[model samples]
Target: MKADETIVNGVRIGGAETKVGEDIRTIELPSGARAEVRKGYGRDLMRAQRAAANGDASAVVFALIAEVTRVDGHKIVYEDVLEMDLADVMALQAEVIDENFDRPPQRASQASSNPDSQSEH
Candidate 1:
């Protein structure tokens, strides 16, 4: 394989190397395997929740991981995560949950404008 080409899930993708950006982050497992996780949006969360319907919190989290993570540059589905070692899965879960769900909600003022701004009369 050439330096610019990568085989992800047995399919080759050739291009410039991808760098981690504000929207994407990397998680390294104890086994030296790495997962590239992207920040998921509300739709991704809703899809994950639906996929884990009636399942426990862990199931939902796993589904979310599947929704947002790529291992070896390949999308790792829920079943792939399930087949992983416990420690690796836990590492992925922690990173995925922290990146996607654990952050405090952004205040409306923080998102749009200053909280102390006065309204026009």
Candidate 2:
């Protein structure tokens, strides 16, 4: 996959690529852990595109943000395969945009409201 290319549930992700299908599956983690993951489609892709267009990072980053947790007695469970924490990606993209575009510094209030503020400090 390309650096900016992302694949989730066998669906290709990009600014122009959308239309995901219901393709969920169970897979083993690098630690030999297993979990069931769901596949997201159309709506998910549109949201990802909006995020990317709104100075958010590429969809690839979002697609890679997997949820992995170990249950006490049961095997690890993974959900929301196409789900991404938009706040995280937005913050990263904001910083890059600011640096490249040389945008003015944001006020305390604006910075505080930003989920990526923690990284800025």
C-alpha-based local distance difference test score of model 2? 0.39
> How would you encode candidate 1's per-residue C-alpha lDDT over 22-86 as one tens digit per residue?
48888788888888888877866776677677877888888888878888877666678789899
Candidate 2 per-residue lDDT over residues 4-61, each given as its tens digit: 5566656444322322663335444433445333444345445445444554554433
- What lDDT does candidate 2 reach at residue 49? 55
Indicate which candidate wins on lDDT.
1
Best by TM-score: 1
- Number of clashes in every candidate structure? 0, 0
User: Residue 61 of model 1: what lDDT?
Assistant: 87
lDDT for each candidate structure? 0.74, 0.39
Off by over 4 Å in 2: 1-23, 53-57, 64-121
RMSD of each: 9.2, 15.5
